[model samples]
Each structure stands twice: as C-alpha cells, then as structure tokens.
Target: MAFIGASRGAAQGRSASALAARLGFRIGLVGLFSGTLLLAALLLFSLQPMFTKRVLPILGGTPAVWSVAMVVFQALLLAGYAYAHALTRWLQPRAALATHVLVLLAGVVFLPVGMAKGFGAPPAEGEALWLIGLFLASIGLPFFALSASAPLLQAWFARSGDARSADPYFLYRASNIGSFAALLAYPLLIEPLLGLDAQARLWSLGYAAMTCAVVACGLRLRNAAPVAAPVEAELTVEASPRRRLAWIGLSAVPSALLVAATAHISTDVAAIPLIWVVPLALYLVSFILAFRPAQPGPDRTGRLLSGLQIAGTGCAFAVVVFKQTPFLLDLGLTLGLLFVNALMAHRAVYALRPPAARLTEFYLCTSFGGMCGGIFAALVAPHLFSGVYEYPLLLAAALLCRPGVTAGGLPAVLREARRSAVPLIGAFLAALLALVARGPQLGIEVLMVCLVLTLAADWRSPARASLVGIAIGVACLALQAAVMAEGGNHRSFFGVHRVYTSPDGQFRLLVHGTTIHGAMRLRDDEGRASTGRPVPATYFAPGGPLSDVFEISRRVNGAIPAVSVVGLGAGSLACHARVGEAWTFYEIDPVVIRLAQDANTFHFLSECAPDARVVQGDARLTLSGRTEQARVLVVDAFSSDAIPIHLLTREALAIDFAHLDAQGLLAFHISNRDFSLSHVLARLAAERDLTLLQRLDPPRQPSVGFAHSPSEVVLMSRDPAVVREAKAMGWRAVTPDLSRRPWSDDYANALEAMRDRWRELLTSAR
Candidate 1:
C-alpha cells in the first residue's frame, strides 16, 4: 500500500511539472512575437523621415517631397499587407513563417540604409517619378519587409495556441504605440542626439535584432497547429464586397486628411520633416484610440462627440476662411478637426471589424484605402485643382462618414417631411444667399452658426444632421473660394501663388502664402498706367539692400557686371540690371518662371532684361554646374516664409564661391518673418574667412509708383572693398556667435537656429 501511494505522488508531480513548462513556453512565445512587432514598427516609421532627410537636398526642400514619400509608403504598405494576407491564406502556419523569415533575411542585404548613389541632379521635369524611383532603389526591400510586420505578426500571434490569441486586433494598438513612440523620438530625441550616419548604423543593429526575434517567433510556431487547420476551431466570416468597400472608404478619409493638413500647415510654416511628423503622429494616436478595446462610456457619448466634431470642423473652416485668428490658432484648429474626424472614421471601421480569421483581409483593405487617399491627395490633386480643393472635399467626405447617417437618411427625411421642412429649407437657402451677399466673413459666420444649431437640435438623427452640416460646410467653402479668389492664383508642387492688386490699383502683388514675393506699381505718381521701364519694387525697391549690392558690384567690377539671381520672384530684380550688364535667373518652379516672364504680368523681366537667360532647376544643383562667373550672385529663393536650409549650408556657400569671380559678392536675401538668419550667415562667413555685411532695410511709406517692403540682405565676399562699400550704405559688419555652430550639409538644426525669433514671434502674437 505505501509503495503504491508513493508512485501515485510521483506521477502527479510529473504532470504538474509538464503544465508549468507549457505555460512558460506560451509566455515566451507571446513576448517574442510582441517584441518583434514593436521593433519592426519603430524601424519602419523612423526610416521614413531619416531617409527622406537624406534625399531632401537632392530634391529642393519642397513639402511636396514629403507628400510623395507618404504616397510611396502607403503603396508599399498595401503591397506588404496583401502579401501577408496571401501567404497566410494559401499556406499552413509553418510554411508562412518560413517564407516570411526568409524574406526578412534576404532584406538584410539592404541594411544600414541611406540614399542610393549615382542619382545625381534631379531632372527639371518628371521630378516626382525620379524621386519615387530613388526611394524604391534605396530602401524599398527593407521597408516592404518591415511593412509586413504588424499584420503578419498579429496573425502569427492568433495562431500561437494562447487563450488571448483569439482576438489579435489588440496587437494592432500596440503596434501603433510603437509607431507613435518612434515618430516622437525622431525629431525630439534621435535627430537632436545622433548624426545621420550614426542613426543609420543604429537602425541596422535594431533590424538585425528584430530578425532574430522573428526567427525565434517562427521556431515557436513551427510545431504548433495552424489556426486554420481542420482540428482547430476558428471563427471565419465572409467579407462581402460592400463590407470591403466600406472598410476602404472609412480608412481613406483620415489618410487623405493627414496629407492635406500636413501640406496646409507646412506651406505656412517650415517644410521640415519635424513639422511633417506632428500630423502623422496625431493620426497614429487616433488609430490607437479607435482600435483599442471599448471603454465604459454612455451610448450617447459617441454621438455627442460626433456632433461636436462636425460643429468644430465647421467653425475651423470659418476661422480659416475669414482669417479671424492667428496662425498658431488656425493650425491648432486644423489639427483638432483632423483628430476628431479621424477618430470618428476609424471608430466606425473598428465597429465593423471581422473575426481574427479575416484579420489580414481587413488590414489589406485598410492599406488599400490609405494608398488611394495618398495618391489622390499627393498625385491627383496637384494636377486636377489650382487650389487645395482636396482639403475641403475630404472634410465633406468625413462628414458623410459620421455616425447616425444612414445610407438613405437624407432622402428618407426629405420624403417624410416634404410638407413641414420645405419652408425651413427655403428659409435656410434665403439666409445663405443673404450671407453670401454680405460677403465671406458674414457668410462663413452665419453658415457655421447654422450648422452648429442644426447639429445640436437633431444629434440623434445622424443623416439629417450630417446632410445639413455638409451643405453648410460646402457653401462656406464656395463663398471662401470666391472671397479669396485673386486673379492668377495657381498651385504647384512648391506652393500656391496669387496675384492681387492693391486697393488703389497702383500695386500688383505676387503673393505666396502670407508673404508678398514682389509688388509692381500699376500706375505712376500722376495716377496713370505708365508703360515706362518697370521699376524694382517690394524687397528689390530702389535703395534696398539688393539694389545696393548691384550698385557696389558695378562700381567694383569697373565694367558690365555678370549677375545671377537664384529665385525669380516676378523678376523684380531684373530692373536692377544695367544696359551693359548680363543677368541670369535660376528658378526652381516652372510656374514662377512662366508668371515672371509673362509680359502682361508685371513685365519686369520683359521690359528691363528681355534677353536674360532663366534656368529652371534647383539652384543648389544648377548653380554648382554653372561654369559662368558672376560678379554678383543673389540667393533669393524662398517659398513663402520657408527658407530652404540646404541653400544656406556651408557646402552650398562653397559652391556659390566657386561660381563667383575673384571680387564677386554673394548676397543672400534673408528677410523672414519667423526666423533670423543673420547669425547663420555670420557663422558661415567666419568659417570660410569671408567678410560679411548685413543690412536691415527699414519699412518705407507706400508710394504710387512703388511699394517699399522691409528687406534684409547679407553680402559675403573675400575682398575688403566689398565690405567697405556695403558699410557706407548702412550695412553693418556682423560678428559670428562662436557658441553657434555653422550649418553644414551633413548637419543643420533649423528650429535651433530660429529659436530666438520664434520666441519673439510668439510673444508678439499673444
């Protein structure tokens, strides 16, 4: 009896030991899969800004570059998700794991990623395609492999035989958390701490680590039964065509809005990746909130938030249209609208999510929608519309996706209330017409207020409320278009340009964003439209620093001077060219070139220097290849208030020097409302042992023949006579701040360089 009892105890102990071992293995598997996914997401997101920064100099520092890069990423994401979906559906667990691991291993060959060599000098035309090809050749393989990670790993986790594996969608939230963390780390921590080379090496090490984790995950899954195998009970549902389309529609709105918001804000501000990441990071946050497990809340809470979203978006549109707020406030409102709208759209998608068996399919559809939205916003809109019509159109689409709006809600409402609602509708239309007559300010205000009241009164009826909201919003947009319509308004890859005549019709201004690029006098002092020689206006007005540079150049050269102007802003500086002088213009945007050369539009180039040569390409690339020597080289290329940092770097200065004669002066138009570049140019001049002269021209009273705008020009030369002549004309010798490092091609901190000016701007705004 005693021997039998002892044997029984030993067998029971052995059974307990086996159970513990299995639990440990399950925990290990979860860690391996989750860790791998987190790392993969981190690398994937961080690589975007890193590689784009690497190639920004090759392209001009246009915000369109980032937009195109997003389109590429979205397309690759769809391909990766589609690939994962195919692999899992066709093959067993072991086969899928093996194939994915092999692909990852193969992708390692593209490690330590940077821009590819031999793609020198972006072509003047087809730049978008060239940029896309450059990205594909450089980091395509690794990025594609990494893009497969979120959906692929979540699918693998579902098949891992753990109880929690039944719903793998939670893993998606974790993935976005990783992505959000990475984007935040980039500009805040990584970029500030490490150089690009170090960043590349570190990313390579992380990639290797992720590969090993992936292998470990694969090995764990190798012996387990596939989730879709006959023995395992898996929940599967048929994804109907309508359901797939719904998924695509819901996902596309936020993606397009993301690009639109980025473009809008970046055009007004700077075009750096740091600014680009803010909207994207918020976009990821919305995904996190939408996809996470439902929290305890009242049923009406979501409806209330939805109503608020619509009202808030309408108000934001009004504020933007009327220019009633500061830039920062406008930016905040735009981002807020994006966040709330995205949350609503993404939540709708989460509500319709299929079971784990259809996980890959759901993600694939989502990626496809993202790709479509990106293509529309980044590719199609630039070709289709002369303004940012995509922004307003997507906002309307988002209103349609709001909850409580049934498919036939508006039609049903109209049919049910034909008798009672007809007068109401007619009254609303009359009010809209009255507001339109009053002008854009009153129109937007009345429309926004009407939308808020309409939404508030019928919050429960989503369809009725959404219809009213969308109509009001669209009407407001139409009114805004009319109000903001200045003749010759055009949009390009760079930014939007508008030509506006001043109130007295004496000045015709070339405007980009809020900055006036050039102003030409339409009528003379005698109030006649004098067709004499075109006078230099705005920053190039007579007695401005730019004019001083020309005077000094001609005097020092003792002959006809060869002048090269980097930016062609209505060709205002062309009037500064003398009869015996040679002038060439290097302009990046073809639209600007066309507008400047048009005889009817300002005609400075045509009237003053009709035979001048205009080169169309990035100045950094085009100027470097020029063999002709310039007695004066003017760097005046600025898109709105955004100064391309690449054009101001030490290497760019070196190129400028190489293209200048022995006594040539390099003048930089550093006039900016948001940043101070005096210190930057001073540092560069000191490093190269060149004399630097800076002048801040005071604002002059407006005259009928010319408008005098504030201007700041910095001149650098190896000759002392150039500095002396500049000082005689109110230009001061600026000393370099030794504490601040000179900006170089390999390193530049635009925010740091502009820190002081930013503080002043904010303080004044308040």
Candidate 2:
C-alpha cells in the first residue's frame, strides 16, 4: 500500500498540473514562514533599531549605533545556525523539539522587549564589549531559538522521509517569503494598528501559535510510520569537497550580486536612497521560481538569464557613466538583473542539491553564506572601502560569470574579444556620459577617451575588461564624490549629509542622513536674537508638534523652560530659543555636531544660543540618568528609515512621564509614510497613564514637517490640560482614539495590525 501510495505521489508530480500545485503551495507556505520568522526578525530587526533610537538622543544621533546593531544580529544568526546544526546532529528529533520549545518558553520570561534603561549611554571605551554582552544576554536566547526554525524544520523533513518527491528546499522559498512579508509588514501594518504595547502582545500571540504548530508538527511526525526510500537515500553521503565548494560559490554569487545591486542602486541616486530591499525582494522571488519539486525544464531560460545579467551590468555601468538616476529605469533593470542572476544561481543550487539525507547540510551552507554576505556588506565593506565603487566593479564581475559547466571549454575570451572588438568599442563610445552639474563638456570629453580605450582592451581580453571597469569605477567615484568631499558634504557611516546655506543667507540649513532636522534664518539669529525672541524652524513650525509645545510654554513664567532635544540635526531647534531659554541637545553622532556647528550652516550656538548645553548619548539613557523637570520634551527619533519600536513602548513613555513637570508636553513625531506612529503613541498614552493629543498636519511642502522619516507628528503629555493647551497653540488632533493597541516591551508585530491597509497606502496620497 505504501509503495503504491509513493508511486501515485510521484506520478501526480509528473502530470502537467503537478508542478503548478507544488509551486503554488510553496509560494503560499511562505506566509507561514513569515509568521514563524517574525519573532526572531523582530528581535534582530526591530529591537536593535528600537534600542538604538532610545539611545540615539544621547549618542548624538551617530550612525555607529545602527552599525553596532548589525554586528550583533549577524553574530546571533551565525550562533543560531551553529546551534541548529548541533541540535539536529546530537539530539533525536523529539529531544530537539522539546529543547526548542523549552528555550522559547524561557525566552518569553525576558519579556517586555526593551534594553535596560540607560543602556544607550556611551560606555567607557573599555566597557563596550561588556555592554554588548549584557545586551545579548538580555535578548539573545529567545532570538537564537526563533532564528533556528528554518534549519530545524528542514532537518525534520529530511529525517521524516515524507514528501519524497518534494524538495526540502521548496520550504525555504516559503521561509524567505515570510521574511519579506515581515520586512514589508512592519512599516505598513504593524506600526499603525497596534502601538508598541499591543504590537508586542500580537507578536507574542503569534509566537505562541507558532510554538503550538511546531509542537503539533513534532507530535504528528513522532507517530507516523516510516517509509523507505527507493534505495537512493543510503548512497547519498556528502559530496566531494570540490562539489561542496561549488554549492557555496553558487550561493555566494547571488549574495555578491545582491550586495552589488544594493550598491548600484544607491550610487545611481543615493539622494532619496533606494535601500537594499528591492534587490533582496527579487532575490527572494528567485526561490519561488527555482525550487519547485519538478520545475519545468530549463528551456531557453538559462541563456536568457545570462544575457540579461550581462546586459543589466552594462546598463548599471552606463548609468554611473551617464550620471542619470533614471530612477524607475534603474529599479527595473536592477530588479531584472537580480531576478535573472538569482534564478540562475538557484537553479544551479537546485541541480546540485543532495538527497534528503543531506538536506540540512545543503541549507547550512546557503544560510551561512547569506549571513556572511550580510556581514560583508553591512560590517566589512564600510570598514574596507570608503565608497560604493565596489558595487559596479562587482556588477562587472557578475557579467563574466558563466555556469561551472559552461566555464570549461568556452570560446576563449581572447578570440571572442578579437571578434567582437568593433561592437565593444561602439558600445563603450555610447557609454561615456557626464553630468551637467559639473561642466558637461570637459567631463564628457574625459569619459569618451576612457571609454574608447576600455572597449579596445575589453575586446581583446577579459582581464583587461575587468581592469578597465575598475578604472571607470575609480573615475566615476572621483567625478561624482571624491573631488568635492570637504565642502558642503559630510560623509559618515550613517549616510551622506549635504549642507547648503540658503541663497537668501537668511536661513542656514542643516541636513543629516536624508532629512533636514534644523534650519535658522538670519533675521532670527542676527539682529533680532539680541532682542530676546525665540526663532522657529523645522520641527518648531507653528503648526508642527514641537512648535505647539513651545507655544504652550509661553504662559509659564521664570527662566524660559530648559528644553531638551534628543536628536540634534544641524541644531535647527537652537534657533527656537527664547530670551532666557536654555536648550540642551542630546545628539548621537559627533559628525552631526561638527557639521552643524563648524560648517556655520545653521548657527544654533554661534548665531542663536552659543552657550546652549550639548549632551551626547542616547536621549533616554541621558534622561534616565537625570532628574531635570522640563515643561516640554520633544522626541523626534524616527527621522530615518530605521524605526526603533522599543522607544515607543508604554514602559519607555512612562519613563518620559517621570522626567516631565505636571504640565510638561512630550511632542512625538509620529509622521511616517510607512507607519501610523500616532496610533502607537495613542496606545502608549493609554497604557502609560498619559493624556495624548495627536496632530496629522503634514507640511504643505514635503520638506516642511517633522524629521523626514516619519510622515506625520503627534504630541503626548501626562496632563490632558497640557495637550489641550498645545491644541489651542495650533496642534491638530487627527485621532482622538485611533483604536489600536499599544506595543509594549513584551511583544509587537506591526504586520498583523495594518497588513490589510498597506497596498492602498502604497498607492494613495503622500
């Protein structure tokens, strides 16, 4: 009966619709993986960002915090993979399952997700390691257990001997699908529906559900009768080292391509900063295409994919040469290239996959390489190369990649180059483009010369082609960025910030990462400043939440309230000081302070308040250490694309409550294109015992509102009267009660809250 059943299953797979059914199931199963992976990713992705934000106000808004968080995540993933490998090897399946469940239960005990208060403060130079170690102890175990699901499940599927016709790797397609959804859902659904508190609960609930499912899966498999392989499983010992290395290369090539795609897209137009997701999204899609148990045969697709990769590389180089963003074009071409390269790489992996007995080892290499790639791009590259030139050079290298099978006995590059010389020269001739921002004539002339020489050499030899491509990258970097580093530009680990003094000379502007945090007008800073008036700019616009707080402070007597700002971007808020107003800034990045102050762009100290105190470290960390009573406190940390969910929790808000005077107003910038932060604030307001009023007035102009990352702003206060006062001072209440639960230190999952509404949000008004 079992042999007949197996034959039926195998026959079903070979039928026309069998592949479709398998592919469909694989794509949809991704949703489940999305749910499973959420907890770990939340710890790695959300918590790190959250902790960094909580501490950013103190660290001076330095990019280093983000960098450090990445290091932690990569290390933890590596550790998790190692643990999964060990568990599958040593423990019997049931024992492994029991251990995972118990570990997960233990992780929940660390609950109410948050770093210890004041952990954000800059540690003594010698204490950084200890600091990180403590943080890992606090959040690491739960994350580690959760991160192991994919590998653990694969190992189980391998051992169970079920779905003999189905590829264990098809499950990975679903896993990545889950990963992409989490990445997308956090910004779109999770943040807006549930405040950090409720979000945490929802995430915790999902974790519970996943745990149950895992337990159920384990229970079902334990009692199932075992089936024999068709005598094939026993023969599949580990392949030779050469073959293993080939698999690693297959995985690594796509990873390298992903990093290159990230760099290419960034270089084309680093302004709005199209992040790494598009490349990664396509990379995930390749699994969907490549991993079916019985995929349609490779038809002409392999050659097509190879052609597109070469073309994509050439086009990417062209954009760099021409100096045009061609935003949509770049996105389309890069995505196309990513898809093709990923498909080819995945197919190669598919062909190379060992039998079910060795499935775990196969995926171990893949995930390890993924973790390695992330470290390379996020950790190593920043330290290794000062610029993104490695991106294009890598793209050039990707074009040369042929399958290992094709690598042997290919037409000699020398012969091919000699035959194709004319076309190569012509193609190079067209690629020499220079921007009008710099003198177009001299730039174009210089590029034309380089292009001709490059084509000539590329047509003759592959090595020469690679060398010429590197030269072009070097030249492009020099022209686009290298020549003008000291003036107007601030290059830091976070991203580039450009300082341009307004043409009128009335307003000095300060830009950081990608947004303008502060601005100062000459009228406010120069002659009028001595007259004892506070200047308003950026967040302090009359209709903005921060400005509403300042307006409420007008009635309070005595030395104008000492205002503490967490994020100091060009010290634009310094211009808002009143006659005796003492403003202390908690800026995270030293580069930000230097650029804002030394550049003389927005003279917060020199022009507005020279004696203002500037404290450095995470704001909450700094605030947690102090007992100052400010009438108004402003938290505007979500200006970057990176949102730290931990900062918006009920617990953290309660800490804010402690530092505020009875009438103190806390202006939270809830404006975000992706998240409904006002809702998060509302949830926190209720949970932390605070009265909250929210304003949804987006600046008429795109650039006028709160820090740029968030699209809207809200002000929360412990006192309802304080909120009411801010309302009278121009604060608009968009949501009296947004009806979403708050995200807490314990659990949060934005994907569940607003997942349904995201598609519309993407298509709707700004």
Candidate 3:
C-alpha cells in the first residue's frame, strides 16, 4: 500500500511540472509581443524631438517647425495604422508576418538616422511645406515602420490563440508606458548624456534589438495554430457611423489640446526639447492610465480626476481672462488642464474601443482624428484667428466630451434640459445686469463663476457641459476683443505680439509673452509726443551695454561702416544706426518687420533708420547668403523669453564670423531671465581664441525716452585693441570655465544651461 501511494505522488508531481512549463511558455510569448511593441514605441517617440531638433536650425527655430512636425507625425501614424489594418485584413497570418518582417528589414537600411542631406537652406517662403517635404525624405520610412508596430503586433498577438490574446488592447497601455518613459528620458537623460550622433547610433541599436524581438514574436505566432476561421470571422463587426464619429471626436480634442498647450507654454518659456517634452509626457501618461483595465472597485479615483479636469479648465480660463497671472501659476494651471482633459478624452476613447478584430480600424480612426486636429491647430488656426483661438476652442471641445445626461425619452431629455436651462438662463441675466451696473471686469467674473457652477452641477450631461464650456469661451473672446480694441495686437506663426501704451501713456511697448521686446517713450513729462527723434529703449537704452558696443567700436575701430542685427523687434536697435552706416536687420518673421516698420505702430525703423535694409528670413539662412561683412554684428534674436538656440550654436557662430570683418565686434545680448548664456558665450570665445568682454549694465531710473531695465552684453573680438578699449569702458573680461562645453549644432543642452543658471542664482543668493 505504501509503495503504491509513493508512485502515485511522483506521477502527480510530474503533471504539475508539465503544467508549469506550459504556462511559462505562454507568458514568454506574450512578453515578446508586449516588449517589442514597447521598444518600437519608444524609438518612434524619442526620434520625433530628436529629428525635429536637427531640423530646427534649418528653419531658424520658428515655433511653427514643431507644429508642422506634429502634423507630419500624425499623418504618418494614420498611414501606418491603415497599412496594418489592410495587411491584416487581406493577408493570411503567416504571409502577414512575412511581409511585416520584410518591411522591418528594409527599414534597417535607414539606420543611424539623422536629418537627410540637401536641406541645407530653407526657402524664404512656404517654409511649412518645405519642412514637411524634408521630414518625409529624411526619417519618414523608418518612422512609418516603427509606427506600424503597435497595431500590427497587437493584431498578430490576438490571432496567436493564447488566453491573453483574447484582449490584446492591454498592449496599447504598455506602448504608451514606453512612450512616456522615452519622452521623460530624452530630456533628462539621453539629451544631456549623448550628442545627437551618439543618440542616433543608440537608437539604431535599439531598433535592431526590437527587430529581433519582433522576429521571435512572429515565430511564436507561426508555431501556434492559425486563428480558426469562425473566430476570425466573429471578430469582424462593422462599426456604425456614429461610433466611428465618436472615436474621431474623442481623439481630436486631446490632440488639439496637446499642440495648443505646448505652443502656449513654450511661448513664455524656451522652445527647446526640455520644455517640449513635458506636455507630450503628460499626454502619454494620460493614454497609459486611460487604456489600462479599470480597477475592481468604485471608480471614485476617476470621478475625482474628472472633477479636477473641470476645475482646472476653469482656472485656465481665469488665467487667460486675467492676463496678470504669475508665470509659474499660469504654466501650472495650463499643464494641469492639459493633463486632466487628456485623461478624460483618452478614457472616453478607451471605453468605446471595439474587440481585437477591429483593433487596427480603431487606431486608424484615432490617428486620422489626431491628424485633423494637428492640421487645424498648426495650419489653420494661425491663419484663421489674430490670436490663439484654438486653445480656447480645444478647451471647450474637451468639456463637451464629459459624461452627461444620456437617459430617458423626449420627456426625460426635456426634464434634464429644464434642469440645466434654468440655472444657465438665470446666470446669463445676472451677467448682463452686472455688466450694465458695474463694468466689464465684474461682468466677466460673474459669467465665469456661473459657467463653472453650471459645469459642476451638470457634470454628467454632455449637452449642459458643452453649453457651459462654450459660454465661458465666448466670454473670454469678448474680453479679448475688448483688450484688442486698444489696437496693435498681432499674431503670427511665431507667437502673439502686442503693442500697447503704458498706463501713463508715456511709453508704447512691444510685448511678447510677458517680456518687453521693445519700448518707445511716446511722451515727455509735458504730456506731448517727443518730436526730436525716436530713442532705443529696453536692452538698447543709450547707456546700456548694447550702447557700449557701438561707443567702444566707434572709438577703437573708427567710424562704423556696416552693422548686422539679428532679431528686429520693433526695430528698436535701428535707432542706434549712425548716418552713413549701412545697417541691415536679419528678421525671421515678416509680421515683426511689419509691426516694427509701421510708422503708425512704431516709428523706430521709420523715424530713426528708414534706409536700414531688412533681410526677412531666418538670420542663419539669410546671413549665410550675404557677401557683405559687418563691422558689428548684434545677436538679439530671442522670441519673447525663449532662446533661439539655433542662432547661438557653434555652426551659427561660424556663419556669423564669415559675415564679420577682421576686427568686427560680436555683441550678444545675454540678458535672459531664465538662462545664464554668458558661460555659453565664454566657451565659444575660448574656442576661437577671441577676447571676451562682458558688461552687466547698471540699472537706471525710469526716465522718458530711456529704458530702466539692466542689460547684459558679451562682446567677442579678435582685435586686442577692441578688447582693451572695451575694458577701459568698464567691460570686464569674461573668463571661460574649462569644464563647460561649447554648444554646437549637434550638441546643445538647454537643461544644462538652465542648471548652470540655477546654480549661479543660488550662489548669488548665498
């Protein structure tokens, strides 16, 4: 009896071992699918900013470059999803796998990716189209291949006959997780650690590894039995027109919001990859959470996030309405709104998802919607509105997606309508009365509060939620109209620029993203428009370091014959052009040139230097074509508070040097609120064995026709006499730190620059 029992126990042990091995094999197969898709996603997303950065210099770092890049990416993504959908729908399982593998191998030919050759100079006109063509020629094929991986592999997994394959949508969450990781890592780790060339090589290696994993996943699928015909047929449910439209609408709002938020935030900050990554990272995180399986419990967490979304939208609206909000607060509120709205929109998409059989179709619709949104925001809105209307429009669209009252028949709808209408009508009347009795400020406040309350009360009803959102958006527009009535508000592909008289009517300022690009004193203490001449204000004030450049240059090198100024903000520096001096302005934006040259808006260029030739294009590109060398070249092409980094790179400097005389003084306006560019300039000076002299001009009292803001200028010259004269004029010798690396076209790091600035601030504070 004992012997028989032992034999039975041993048999049972073998049975358990066999089952364990089978389970492990299934898990490994699923892991291969998930892991390869994740890697593919990482490569796809990280390459976006990487390649865009490479192309930025070509176009002069216009914000539109990023916008156009987004449109291209979305279009490619749609193409990829469509390809996957077609391949799966037409081919047998083994044939589809074979075709996809061939595409992967073909993509390998485009390895060690960087910007393609022959796009050396951007055309003066039709820049957006040129950029699209450039991207298509360069990274298009590899990116399209990578974009197809998620949908194609998921479709393959669904046909593999494993239990996990029954619901392959979970792999999407894994894909976004990889995307989120890549975006975060690019700014924080990859960009800071590796140069663009090194990054490209590393990405190539990653792609090779992902190809191996894809082959493994394909092998596993091949070993498994082909999907039963009945099962495959069962998965082919046609989506109704309504459901497809819902998917597109749900996808469009978040996509538009992403572009708008990035544009809005980066306008106030630098338009570099570090700032660019934050919005995109939040966007990916939203996808990761929205697509993940719902937790087993009451969805209190989701409801809370929904509430936050509404609240954040309200806060963002308030910030826009009241333009005096602090920068940090404004940034936080806008980013918070983006995060919550994206979460809500993506969750809606996830909830409406079809079975694995329709997986590629769903992604195709989503990608199409995304492409449409990108085109509207990046292509249409700039031309459609004088301001950033898309931001508010997208905000309203996001609110419209909120879960709302969708129950009962006509009577039930009428009941819900009545419940919503009473409060809205009452609030509208109250706002009207407030406007008549008090003022626009009080009226707008009342309307905003009412909208917020209505949205909160009817949070579950889409109609009511949309009504509230539209109401708020209309109110905001009215406020903007009122503000623009003062005249001189202009919007372009770069950013918003406003020309407004100061409170005292003593100065007219050209403001861009809360930074004063140019200010002209309009009246004297006697309350009359100054009749003598227009004076250079802000950084170019008469006694500022910028003035010192001309003063010392004229003193040391004799009469200045030619000067080239990059960045033509209100053409304030044009006031510095002496008679007989052939001054040229290299301006990127035509709108800026128009605003600055208009005698009605600003008379600096007209009244001070009417003959100052304006070369309208990216300074780097335009300057490269110039044959005349300048005695002085002023680098002052900052877009609001953001640095045009392409203008400050080593390659750019080489171009500038080629356009300068032997003793030409290169004056860099390094007075930035967020970055210490002195170190960067110092390093560049050292590389050329040039003398670097810097001056932080002392602050002055605010007087009519004079700017009070202190300016920091760095002067680089190979002439010892020029440096000696600058030093005698209170310009201190700028010491280069051997530890700091000079920023090149292939290797600039905004994060490092920001960190150095922070360290300096800390040291100064101590």
Question: Ranking under TM-score, best-scoring first?
Answer: 3, 1, 2
**TM-score for all models, in order of appearance:** 0.92, 0.66, 0.94
Better of 1 and 2 by TM-score: 1
Model 2 earns a TM-score of 0.66
Sort the predicted structures by lDDT, highest score first: 3, 1, 2
Candidate 2 C-alpha error for residue 334, in Å: 6.8
| Candidate 1 weakest lDDT stretch, 10 residues | 228-237
Model 1 lDDT per residue over 138-174, tens place: 9988999889989988888888777678888988987
Model 2 C-alpha lDDT per residue in residues 290-337, reported as the tens digit of each score: 776544787566656655554555566666556456456767877787
Q: What global local distance difference test value does model 3 have? A: 0.83
Best by TM-score, which number? 3
Query: Would you list the C-alpha lDDT of every candidate in the order shown?
Result: 0.81, 0.58, 0.83
For model 3, residues 68-104, the per-residue Cα lDDT tens digits are: 8999999999999999999989998778878887888
Better of 2 and 3 by TM-score: 3
Q: C-alpha displacement of 553 in model 1, angstroms?
A: 2.9
lDDT of 3 at 724: 82
